[model samples]
Target chain A: MTRLAGRIGRFAWEIALPIVVLSYWWLATADGDNPFFPPASRVLEAFWSNWFDERFVSDFLPSMARLGASYLLAVGIGVGAGLLLRLWRPLGEIVEPLISFLRSIPSAALLPFAVLLFGIGTNMQVFLITFVCVWPILLNTMDGVADTDPTMLDTARAFRIGHRRRLTRVVLMAAAPRIASGMRVSLSVAVVVMLISEMFASTNGIGYVTIQAQRTFAFADMWSGILMLGLLGYLLNLLFVRAERLVLSWYYASKGR
Target chain B: MAPLLSVEGIGKIYGEGRSAYRAIDSVTFDVNESEIVTVVGPSGCGKTTLLKCISGLLPPTDGRSVLNGIPVTEPPEGLGIVFQDYSRSLYPWMSVAHNVAFPLAGKGIPRNEINDRVERTLAAVGLRGQQRKKPFQLSGGMQQRVAIARALAYQPKVLLMDEPFASVDAQTRAELEDTVVALRAEFNVTVLFITHDIDEAVYMADRIVVLTPPPTTVSEIVEVSLPFPRDQIGTKELAEFVKLRSHVYRAVKNRWDDRQPGQ
Candidate 1:
């Protein structure tokens, strides 16, 4: 019962800031005089009507599909590249500067180039999302792998554990927490890039629907689309956090902190 | 027959030029099959450096260490090491059983055989019921026992320990010392144990090698002819045990005296 009460307390603590912000937003937008700030109730009404409609479902599913494919692809490729760099230091030195330079430019800035190369379609959005999300995962994985305790490595070596087993048992386990943290950051990047690419050049997707609504002065529809995107981002972050907790329970529990 | 392991005039000087320092200088020792050899010395006396050389973690600068007629190059297949810090020695993410069975995985051993070996080893270490627990979940002494079990399960020809019991509380340390004595007899494994405690050195070793301060060198080798299946309470009360303990204590004290400038 005490644990339940503590959890309830924590839940209330977490929602307090968001509740205050939402109340302020409702009060500020009551008159709906500002073009940018629509009334909160109007936004909610728009969301309810558009959310269940077939048009919204079609665009939402495609956007979600694109986001999922791009994010998974980025994780696979980024982790692979980071492991390769860790295994070979000379290769890491040669490519590190190039990776940093590429990561420095805003991913949205590459939309025109992406359009030129892959055309303004799902491919362009997928490519941009993958590009933007890869950096954090790659860098974090590299740091995690490199940071494996030398004593543990020596212990592994002394036991004559082979390279493959060592990587799987020791290296990957040690790196999981750091890599999970990186994936959380990368997921947000993936969602943002997905929306940006759709907004830049696309005949479909939630971003395209949002842009079309605004252009046609369908303010309520635009507000609904933006609301949906915000919800999607929040839901994705929560999922990643849940996954991290499941995988890294041992790490946190061991410290007893 | 030759000893199971031999270190001949082994010396290690790290780095070069102005940064160079000799960590171990002209240190030599040997361990007969089924014998327990303990190396005791003050801090920074290159005791750990000597163990590293014997276990093939670090190559000697001037001389060679041979194990079963082969020159020690890398960490040998049948050699196990238990470091001082138990927390760092065992992989934290793996369960105790998995950590123990890790060394036997690719050696053509069957799954059931691996499980049996891990269980038996954990049982031998008095940790039979805690196989599923991760190393971090255990107490410090328990973690050290898991480390020992991991090493023992490897069935190494020689077990090299670097101050394995230094981190635990006094009571746990005594129990672990008893555990090591039991393990030595049970396995008939050649043990090269290192410690800073005089009494522990005399208690756990068949022979004790005392080392001087850095640039460290072996000062004396004391033989402990205590009978097997030794009990801590009775053994500590023996006249022979008292004499040997005092001798080692004085030898260490003398080394400390000699180390001071103009002594």
Candidate 2:
């Protein structure tokens, strides 16, 4: 019974902020004077109506599909590039400046160029999302690989372990915690880029629904779409954190001690 | 029979021209098959440089080191090394068993044979039940034992150690010293152990080679005539052990004086 109460206390601690925010929104927007702010009940009603509509399914699924595709692509290409940069010093030196310059350019600013290049299809959305997400993963992975302990490398050498096996067994295993951190950062970036790309050019996606509702003066629907996007982002982040905890339990335990 | 390993007029100089620093100057030593040879010296006297040259980890500037009649061009096969820092010497990600099994993986040993050898070697080091524990999980002494197990599992003809117990507590160091003595007796493997501690050198070595300071050379070689199955208290209290320890201590002190700035 004590353990159960402790768990409930922990649950309350986690949800406290969200509950307070919801309560404030209900209280503040009850008189409906503000054009920008909708009451919690009206937003909930709008959410239920749109959530069950068949047309809304098409937009939401396509946006999620695009996010998945872009995130996977970014991870694959970014990790591959990171490995290349780490293994080859001269190549890394040559490309590092260019990669830094590219990363400095705001990702949202690339939407216009992305639309011109990919012509406002699913491809454009994916390209933009990949562009925004790849930098964090690539930089983090390279840093991770570079920071792998030299002593461990020497240990591998003393044992006569070959280069390929050494890299796989020692270097990568040592770099895992850093790489997980990078992936978590990239996941949030992927979601942000997904919505931004849809807002800028896409005909189908949650962003498009939001844009349509705003243009049509459907204030409650617009608020509902915004709330859904925020919820989706929060859920994605939570999922990444959970996965990181599961996969890197050893790293966490070792670091904690 | 010829010595199991030989080093002839080995010299190592770091850098070149005006900046040149001579570490070992024409030093020579050899280890007979199944013999334990310890090199003792004061700090900065190039005893470690000599061991590095012999182990083929670093090439001597002007001389050759041969193992089994072949000149060592790289870290030669059938030779293993245990460094002082146990934290740096073992891969943290690998289990103790895997760390022990590491060196043998290249010899094309069957998987079962590798497991058998790792288990046997860990048992020899008194770490049998801790196979799955990572190196970081173990105590410093236990980690060093894992290092010893790794070197032993390699089944090397020659093992080189660089002040392997300098960092451990006195009690743990004594225990590890006994473990080495027992291992040397069981395996009959040649050892080229390097240390700055004269007492440790005298206690563990069959023959202790004392080195002179920088631009170092062999100053003396003291044969330990003490009997085997040695205990720390009993062996250290022996009259001969005390005499030899003092002799090594003096030799190393003289070298330090010789390498003094004005000398």
Candidate 3:
């Protein structure tokens, strides 16, 4: 009983500030006289009704699917290209300037161009997110692969471990921590770019719904859309953090020592 | 009879044209089958370059190293190396057991046999029950033992050690030296070990090859006929050990002293 109470106390401690602010919001806006701002309870009620019934299926799920697909594609191609460039130095040197130029162009500026190229749908959304997020992943993986200890390479060579085996076992494993950090940065980029593309050109997705709510002056519904986006970002980050812990446990364990 | 390994006129030149620097210069030697040969020299005397050439990690600009009657243009199948920096050489991400088992991954060996060999090799290095521990979790000496176990697990025809005990403290170094001696006898593997320490050279070698200072070549090769099953205390106490130690020490010192002005 004491342990359960202690656990609850700890949980409450974590949420204390947020709870206070939320209570303040509810009380201050209870009169409902404000034009733009709704009471916290009304926003929550709007969120429960709209998201649970229809908007979640149409807007939220499609947005999340785009995010997942784009992020996974970026990781796959980024890691592959990074390893290739690391192994083949001349190619990296030649392509690096072009990569820099491409990454430097603000992704928002490229949305209309992407829309023309792929047309507005999941394709345009995935293309935009992947294009922007790939840079961090590729560059980080390249740096990580290049920085593998020369002595370890020599050890692998000396042991007669073949090129393929050595690359996978020695180089890839050595670079995993850096690659994982790169992926985290890419994840946020993926989420933001997905939202941006959907807002600019798409007929569906959470961003489109949020904009639609704002245009209609359904302020509580707008708040709910904002709430869903925040939840999506937070939940994705939570999942990524947990996965990273498992994949790079060896790296963290050694660092802890 | 042909030597188990022959290093013939090996030389390594870095850079090009005016900036070309000769790291090794026509160094030559041979290791008999199952013989333990140590190369001792002053620091920066290209001892590592010579070892790298022998192991085929670095291609010599001239000449070649032949192992088991085959030219070592690349890392030969039956050769193993234990590098000096155990921290960098052993994969920190791999457990002690996996690191030992790595070299045999695609050698058509069964998984059970590979595990058996890993277990036996880990036991040989006195790390028997600690197979699951990662390299960083072990002490410096124990990490080196894992490296040695990795080399031993391969059952190489010759083992090349590049100052493998330099990082460890005196007690661990002494213990590791004994382990090498025992492993050498038990495996009957030829060894080409390099160190800057004359005492280490004298202690471990059946014959010691002393190389000159930078742009190095063999200055002398002194034979050590100390009997087998040598201990840290018992072996060093012998007059023969002392004599060989001083001889190699004087040779290394003289080569460094004899370097010309601006060299």
Candidate 4:
């Protein structure tokens, strides 16, 4: 009984701040005089109804598919380009200025150009999200690959490990920690950019639904959409953290020593 | 017969124009087949530069190194190197057996052959049961054993060791020295060992190629005809060992000191 009580106490510690804020919100909004900010109970009720229905299929699922495809593309291009640039310094020197210049254009500004090129729907969304999020991933992987210990390289060469095998087996493994960290940063960026691009030009996604709810004066629906977006971001980041722990356990284990 | 490995007038000059530095003026030496030759020099004496050129990791500014009749323009396929930094040289991300098997696996050797070599070399280095542990998880000496095992797994024509035992403790260093001495006999591998430790150079080598301070070249080649089965205490106590140790010591230092301290 005491052990169960201790476990409950630890659980309560995590939820304490959320409970306090929620309670304050519920009490303050109980009068229902405000249309812009709905009562907490109504918003929670809408959260269930708005999401656990057809919009879940139409709105949430597409957002997820886009997020998955775009993030994968970003990682693939970022790591591949990063490795290429690191292996060839002269190429990096030639291309880096152009990369920096491209990175500086506010992704919002890049969207219209992208929309004209790819013409709305999945391609545009994937294109915009990947463009915005890939820089951090690329830059981090490049730095990590460049930072590999020279002694390790010499060891590989001395042992007659071929260049391709050396890069894949040795160089890439050494740079994995940094690559993972970059992916972590870019995960959040990818989620945010996905929403923004959806809002700007998407026909149907969580961002489009949320913005539509506000425009149509369905404030409770808007609150529910916001809640679901938060949950989606939280879930993705959680999954990524778990994956990072599994893949880079050695990097962390050696660190603890 | 021609020497199995030859460092033919190897010279290296860093940079060009005003900032040019002569790291190795001219270093020439040879190792007969299955012989252990120690290249002993002081710190900052282009010891590493000389080895890199010989291994073909670094191009000599003038002349070339020949491994069997082939000039070494790239890391020769038949040579293995155990670097000085044991921790850095053994991939920290790999398990003990995996690090040993890396070169063979990289070469697309059959899995069974790689596994056999990995098992044998790990046992040869006294790391028989610790194959699953990562390099960083092991002691400094054990990490070096993984490196040595990695080199030996390949069955190279010549092994290049660069002050490989420098970082371990004295007890561990002594044990590793014995391990190398035994492994050399067991594997019959020619060794081009580089170190600054005079006693080690004398103890481990069949011939000590002592080098001048900087802008370095071979100062002398002192033959150590000490009988096989040399132990640390027993061999160091011998009169011939003492005389040859001091003789090579003077060649490295360019003068004599009676104290005979460890460099």
What local distance difference test score does each model get?
Answer: 0.89, 0.86, 0.90, 0.90
Error of 1 at A124 (Å): 1.5
lDDT, candidate 3, B226-257, per-residue tens: 98888788999999999888888888887798
Off-target runs (Cα >4 Å) in candidate 4 are A1-12, B106-108, B255-263
Question: Candidate 2's residue-wise lDDT over A1-257, tens digit each?
Answer: 99999999999977997789888989999998887777778889998787658656788888889999999999888888998899998999999999999988888889899989989899988988898888888998899999987657655665677887877777888888887788888898888888888887878788888888999888999988898899899999988888888777667766663
Model 3 agreement with the true structure over A1-257: per-residue lDDT tens digits: 99999999999987997788888988999988996889888999999997888877888789889999999999998999999998999999999999999989899999999989999898988999999999999999999999999999999988888889998999999999899999999998888898888888999988898888899999998898888888878888999999999878888888893
The C-alpha local distance difference test score for the whole of candidate 1 amounts to 0.89
Q: In candidate 3, how many Å is residue B98 off?
A: 0.9
**Per-residue lDDT value at B204 in model 4:** 88
Best by lDDT: 3
Docking verdict class for candidate 1: medium
Which residue pairs of candidate 1 clash? none
What value does DockQ give for candidate 3? 0.82
- The sequence of per-residue lDDT tens digits that candidate 2 reaches over residues B1-263 is 88888888899999999999988888888889988899888898887678778877778998888899999878777888898888878877678998888777767899999999899989999998999998888889999999999998888899888899999998999999899989988877788889988888999989988888878888877788899988899999999998998888888887687657887
Overall local distance difference test of candidate 3: 0.90
Q: What part of the reference interface contacts, as a 0 to 1 fraction, does candidate 3 reproduce?
A: 0.91
Cα error of candidate 2 at position B11, Å: 3.3
- Candidate 4, A1-257: lDDT as tens digits: 99999999989987997789889999998888999989989999988887888878988899989989999999999999999998899999999999999878787888899899998898999999999889988999999999999999999888878888898999999999999999998899888888888888889999988998999999998998898889888988999999988888888888992
Per-residue accuracy of model 1 over A1-257 as CA lDDT, tens digit each: 99999999999978997999889989999999987778999988888887767865678788989999999998998888888999999999999999999999898789889999999898888889999899999999999999998889889888988999999888888888888888999999988888888887987888888988999888988999998999999998998888777788888877784
Best by DockQ: 3
Best by TM-score: 3
CAPRI verdict (incorrect, acceptable, medium, high) for model 3 = high
